[model samples]
Target: VEHKVLAGPFARAFPDAEFYATDRQYSFPLNLPDSFLGLPPWTRPLPESGAASDGSWGGEFDHEVLTVKPGPGSMYQDAAFFHGPSGTLLICDALFAATEEPPPILTEEPEYLRALLFHARDTPQEIVEDTPEARRRGWRRIVLLFNFFFPTSAAVADLGVGPLLNLRPYELGWGGWMPFRWKSREAEEEAFNKYSAGGSPTMLPIIQIILSRGGSGEDTLRWVEKVKRWSFKRIVPAHLDAPLAMGPEEFAETFAFIKKGRNEVRFCDQDVAFLRAAEEGPLSFSVYKSSLGVLRGQPCGP
Candidate 1:
């Protein structure tokens, strides 16, 4: 049955349990203790002899099901429910759609950079870089997500916080499990070596260049316009893959371009001439696009 139908009965059985009730939805928590949640008493652990294992709980009813929905004030909340073998309640949380503004981008800040690096420490830096291979092949950034039920490593990869950074998306339970095996170690090492030899890349130089030439407010706008033109033509579409996937030569050229832009910024910094440059407002760009299929397209009225 659907979650709505089950909510009332479950709630009646466990009144003190927290009920997350939105205007049009409801959910119950499942917080059963470990003692009551383990295998039934009659069942024994597997034997080395490999004889037919004893039937589970010796014919006792042994199954469970839960229904949940997103909770209020947060993406998810805890839930609890009971089972038959033992009258125990299980606790778990559920996630719902986001209903608030997303966090701002803070990529330029040193702290943010440090956190990003820390999260990526075990990852092969090359795969995530805009390497020559990435540029020639028209590679862009890759996005990966993991679900709660998967292992911690899988979850980290999903959140873009782990070693699986460069790899394409793969399912956890399916054949995708092979990628986590020991055989993949060699590939990871080779990629890491490549990244170490090549150096880190950043877009800060491009930002500096645009800001410098466009010293005034109008110039800043012009810089943004240039960015629009360049990005739409060369960068935006790269979002489909990752930078490292680009071919070697193209990646090298892109790195060189970024390096040159960075050096130009450094050169400008050495002189006091550009210090007084100011604009009426902050430089900003609208990266939002309808074709990207983000939240902007949702029909929900404001």
Candidate 2:
């Protein structure tokens, strides 16, 4: 396999990160000999033991083994890679199933990897493929992860599904696979509506937004408006120190005010409630962009 160098732009954006080490013989933490800005513990390998069930021995084999743990501190920390204010690109070993693990790291070798990037509005097909720039840079197997947030309008595009499209086929080899499971949108909406009616702290809609497979820009704006309205009516008055509320239309006006870059909006009780809900899981509000050029969900603990 060709040893591809990390992209210069990526390096510049994340000065402290390092390239993946191919050697498995080396030990954890120590194995990452290259200098890196201190990363989280999950990035390092930890000693663990798992039982082997072959049924032939009739006994479980218990042994301490070295394993890699994925965490926010390592590759995930560089929010620029996942979600940027505009767009971003990120590279990682594997995108594991939500239930299997935290941030899944590839350990075995078929050299599996995931490349994520985002675009502004429409996919720049020409720029991605048949372009001297990318070809000269030695980019192969570019697969497009359709933006779940904006499907009809892709945040990034121009890549094909399989290797035939100058991209590699997604394979389940990195210890696990992408769990095709997603939360039910209708269920989430109902829960959100119920919460709003009763002024109960809930995170269903936020989770739905995060896990949504596709929607238009208008849809996103609409959803944001809904969030704002729910916050205003249900969470704000009940939670905020100083009660303030706005309808969906009024919240849009407030959003416009914030977007004007005039003044920062102060956190209200509703905001705190939303944040707390996000922290509790079943919700994602990460604004960081990934290499695929889309905002990635916040890291939810396992």
Candidate 3:
């Protein structure tokens, strides 16, 4: 374990809080406390696949925390997965979310945190009286409730089978949830069809980054297949405002964009292939070079 940029603030904010890391390799400019290693609540490195049993986590966290290192290797070489108590399967940078919604804020921030709950789909409140005390109490209760239910402290997510991706602590205030600002509904729909099957264009870059690492087109498919086994009912990606709640039988449809991009890799321009090949090292010279290409603007060919 190593110290992150937020280590100081984190330590200052929660003096008693403990830290944890996955089995994957980690390093930083600063040294991390040894207590984080193999400690209680931290648990051991999670299994590479399958539903992690309750006892596996020592029951310290109340819910299962399954770890899924992307196939071939971890994403960004520093990614980790966890099955949150809310039934949400969390991913680090392996995936992202995007949509055409405005930043969910009420006026300037400070009020944003409290304002967000007023609009949240799952906000437990029904009648919020119009009063300073009522508003303050309501906001406090929501925050406390979310601390346990959604747990944004690590990464905010709802009680569903969804994932959120990398959001700098800074951008968290700027509404990191809405990653993409669509220029138009038509353009948005077009990109949606090509990138995320009208669900999340954020998956495009993730797939590209994966392919740049010599990722097999099947990575998303395989991961999705395994996720299906977990019987997750919803998807709350960190980037997108909309939670993906597809039918169990039609869940695979949500990832159609990734599958399409994977299949279309072979059709990518020669230059893009060469670039990816150069980045992926010499592992599969011809395979990766020829099979993994950019999806944003496909080249017709040389």
Candidate 4:
């Protein structure tokens, strides 16, 4: 932890300054076994998740670290930084608020527009009109598909962890998920409402998969509670919109599904079919014996 704090660009920028991550981040990085996100005043240490999650605070903001045991494809670790002075909350991939328009940074790259226009078309051979209406249509599709992985009636076109490239080759137009049908604009708009929880921020499908599979969501709920303790007037995620006008309560509401302890958080169930299949298949974990299964580290099975 000290290494991460002292070795990066920040360390280089201010060689005289000291640095530290949040409690769990400093104590349990790369997820020390059984560790989970926790609450903090940054003075007292809490013993949970098989270790002492120490506290640290300084500089101009408060930070909270969240480490989750979600399997592959999930945000294994992230932290939230709240700058009380500015009422701004800094967050990474754990949360997102999809924007109606593509972020200007992305649009600066012309290939991004082509990527959007390509998605706007249902078939590879279909033409993508360059009108504002066509751009809006394409942007919405990109956001939905990126968030849901595979929205109903829409096939995937490489939700790559890297940049979104213009994949059309030799004037053939679109390359991935060719011939797939896209849902009507009206239906896609409705789906956005469901995913965004009626125009507010919501967990990305990839991240929600973690809560849904977290065995009644107890671990994740605990984390959400810790985050809700923060007082942030706005949230700025690593991706998507910046400086979202959201109070802490509005942010917490997105995780209400975890409080229910089930997969009741519906965002077009059909759209998340792939996510469902994952929890039940490749990412599933369970008790192999008695109540001691967890104690014995036998909580996961084939």
The number of the candidate with the highest lDDT is 4
> What ranges in model 3 sit over 4 Å off?
1-4, 7-12, 15-18, 25-87, 105-206, 211-215, 218-220, 247-251, 254-290, 294-302
lDDT string for model 4 (168-227, tens) is 453424344353456466677666666555346767766665545434256656766777
Model 4 C-alpha lDDT versus the unseen true structure? 0.57
Model 2: lowest-lDDT 10 consecutive positions:
94-103
- CA deviation > 4 Å runs, candidate 2: 1-35, 38-180, 185-302
Worst 10 residues of 4 by lDDT: 292-301
Judged by whole-model lDDT over C-alpha atoms, candidate 2 comes out at: 0.25
Clashes by residue pair, model 3:
162-235, 162-236, 163-237, 164-238
Candidates 2 and 3, the one with greater TM-score:
3
Better candidate by lDDT, 1 or 4: 4
Name the regions of candidate 1 deviating beyond 4 angstroms: 1-22, 25-106, 109-112, 123-143, 146-302
* lDDT over C-alpha atoms for residue 52 of model 4: 30
The model with the greater lDDT, 1 or 3, is 3
Q: lDDT ranking from best to worst?
A: 4, 3, 1, 2
TM-score of 3: 0.43
Compared with the true structure, what per-residue lDDT tens digits does model 3 show for residues 113-195? 44543433222323344444433333333332221222122113343422134233432243333222223333223323333
